[model samples]
Target: MIVKTKAIVFSAIKYSEADLIVCCFTQDVGIKTYLLRNILKSKKSNLKTSYFQPLTQLDIVATNKDKGTLEYIREAKVLLPYSSLHTNIVKSSLVLFLAEMLKNCLREEEPNPILYMFLEESLQWLDEHEGVGNFHIYFLLRLSHFIGFYPDASNMKHDYFNILEGNFQETKTSEYCLEGETVENFKHFFNISVDDISSIKLSKTSRANLLELLLTYFKLHVQGYQRPKSLSIINQLFV
Candidate 1:
């Protein structure tokens, strides 16, 4: 079936010598990988390699085989042309890290319209904003809502956040729960928006600590998940 959808580019890999394999998270089909043939050999093809950059949203027409094999793109165009995400080093690293995270974490092949919308809005917000040091931290927190295991914030008066159970607790149970300063920062992140992300600052040590805590939280909830390789680079950028 030929289908049209809005897709967020998760990652792209070179196929053979002239083609490319692009994996995208689509609104109508969850996650789909498409084969772009021989655009590297033609300057007039209009589907330049630049379009496959991390988290670049695109309107795509493709063959939806749905047989667990790579589909082919009939047409593609940028849905949002970013002004700063690709050019700014800090923002670009954040994008790369987030993209890698999605590549590993997003495994469904069915449509998730809400998740697609959340990512679309978040990426657009990232592109339009500046000095968004805490953007990825906030994004990961919010993304947990859709990916399952969003922290239960109703009982916020507790002393610790139990990562595996996704709730607050007055007593520490194991290595999975975050206590003290990390819990406080997690609470702060839960209440922030993209507009407020830039203003909410973190010391290098605190930021690094929170990131490790978040990764631990993700590993406990997401099965077969591994830490993103770009995580170290992202942490260094903040320091």
Candidate 2:
């Protein structure tokens, strides 16, 4: 079936010299990877290579077989052309890190409107906003909800957090427990808004440690999840 939908480019990989393998998360379909034949060399092709950049939002008309095989994109255009997401050094680095993350963690092949909109609106916000050094961290925290392991903060008064179990606890039951000021920083994001991100301040050390903890949580919950290789890039830029 041919369907037109909004998608976010996760990553584009070069294939067989000139062709490209583009994996995208569509708003209508969960995840669809397309084979772009000779897009690198065929300038006449309507699908420009730039549209496949990490986390680039697009409107795509694609063929979906739903058979666990690669599909093809007949036509695609930038749905929301970013003004600063690709140009600004900080935002671009975060984009790369976040893009690699989506590719690694997101794998459902069925439509999820809630997850789609969360990503769509958030990308637009990132492109338009300033002072988003912690945006990637916030993004990952929220992504856990869709991926099915959001922290259980109902008992936030607890002294520790069990990263593996994702619950607030009064005692450290095992090595996966997080305590002290780190617990406070992690809890600061429980039910906060993007606009409120700037309200909470963390030094560079706190930021790095908090990100590491989040990554650990994802690794425990998400099978086959790997930390993005571009993480070091954003780690340096966000500082």
Best by lDDT: 2
Name the lDDT of candidate 1.
0.88
Candidate 1 stretches with Cα past 4 Å from truth are: 44-46
In model 1, how large is the Cα lDDT of residue 225?
88
Candidate 1: tens digits of C-alpha lDDT, residues 101-166: 898889989999989889989998898887787888899899898998898899889988998899
Name the TM-score of candidate 2: 0.97
Give Cα distance to truth, residue 112, candidate 1, Å.
1.2
Model 1 Cα shift for residue 192 (angstroms) = 2.7
> Which ten residues in a row are the worst by lDDT in model 2?
230-239
Best by TM-score: 2
lDDT of every predicted structure (CA atoms)? 0.88, 0.91
Residues 27-127 of candidate 2 have per-residue lDDT tens digits of 99889899999999997999999999999999999998878888999999998999999999988888888998988999988899999999999999999
Judge candidate 2 against the unseen true structure and give its global Cα lDDT, from 0 to 1.
0.91
